[model samples]
Target chain A: SAVISQKPSRDICQRGTSLTIQCQVDSQVTMMFWYRQQPGQSLTLIATANQGSEATYESGFVIDKFPISRPNLTFSTLTVSNMSPEDSSIYLCSVSQRADPTGELFFGEGSRLTVL
Target chain B: QQQVKQSPQSLIVQKGGISIINCAYENTAFDYFPWYQQFPGKGPALLIAIRPDVSEKKEGRFTISFNKSAKQFSLHIMDSQPGDSATYFCAAAPSGGYNKLIFGAGTRLAVHP
Candidate 1:
């Protein structure tokens, strides 16, 4: 089991501004993932933040828009750059422990961003 | 290309009745299946999980039934209560790699007292 905390639980930002959401894990995790949940939608994979090197982004997502940084095993940050009204959604951080074959993800409280 | 597909965008069940949500996946490589429950303003929490090697796994009122051949799985909430009213999401992950998850659209369940 792992505990995760996300900062700026809810934020209201103006369009064209950027917001960085931080995720802190209680224990060292092998993988950290960033996800986006639009209004009344499912979770969409934004990227996989590795301890080193660049993140692995899914289709339709790029590093320019969602820049991820995994400085260590227990912390990661995701920046939603050049935000728009369309970017108004909940940003979630999830982590998976090492040697966990089930790949169960423990998530943070999530950062709810409202773009006006 | 939604890797994971969930059914019944919303469900309403009476108290003491059973609430079931179904999900299917197209990726044969996916071996780990997990269901998450979310309240109105909280993050999704893992309710139950099952691997392809097993047919079913249950924890208290939450049960996960897996059908590897059909590439499908379902979550059964027995003896539902009003507190069970929330959104449920079914997610799938490949065996290895970075363990990135692909999520379904989610099912909103309302258990009336």
Candidate 2:
């Protein structure tokens, strides 16, 4: 399984400001997933970042609000643009291990963002 | 509408008791079901997972009971202890579609010592 290190583990931003979160995997992977967990809420899929391609965003999310960058297979970044209090949540980055071959994925420690 | 639905927003159990959380999915294409456990301020970690081919899977203190016919799956924690107190989430992913998971609202479990 790949070990993921996420930066800006926690952040506090003012309304209308933006913050960028980065995730680095120990090993190369094809698909890197980004998730958001609001306080006392379920984890929501933000997008799937494929290296060398535009990210596929889930319904209710868009590239303009949550811009993602997948420079390579092992790393990706998710930026929250024009932040608001509703955007405060715990952001997670995850990748599946090819060894399992079962589609089971592993996740990073998560970056908790709080928009004031 | 939520693709996956979960029951009992919260649960409480005593030591050596059994803790169960149930989830139902509306998508029949989902082939993978996984359960995740999250501690305070930590990311959710995979607990156990099951495929449609199997009805049950167990790993140590955790177990996944899957019902393909009903499109429902559950996680059972045996010998529930205070250490097991945390939030558990049930998620499902289809064969394709980038394997993006659809997660349940999550169930907060509190095990008394």
Interface RMSD of each: 2.4, 3.0
lDDT for B98 in candidate 2 is: 27
Per-residue lDDT of A27 in model 2: 88
lDDT of 1 at A24: 96
Count of residue pairs whose backbone atoms collide, per candidate? 0, 0
lDDT of 2 by residue, B48-88 (tens): 88888999999999999999888899999999999999999
Instruction: List the candidate 2 regions with Cα displacement exceeding 4 Å.
Output: A99-102
Q: Could you give the TM-score of chain B for each candidate, in order?
A: 0.96, 0.95
Instruction: Name the lDDT value of residue A107 in candidate 2.
Output: 88
**What tens digits encode model 2's per-residue C-alpha lDDT throughout A45-92?**
898887888998989999999999998879999999999999999999
Backbone clash pairs for candidate 1 read none
Q: Candidate 1 lDDT, tens digit per residue, B1-113?
A: 44799999999999999999999999887878889999987889988888899999999999999999999999999999999999999988877642567889999999988
* For model 1 chain A, the run of ten residues with the poorest summed lDDT: A98-107
Q: What is the DockQ of candidate 1?
A: 0.61
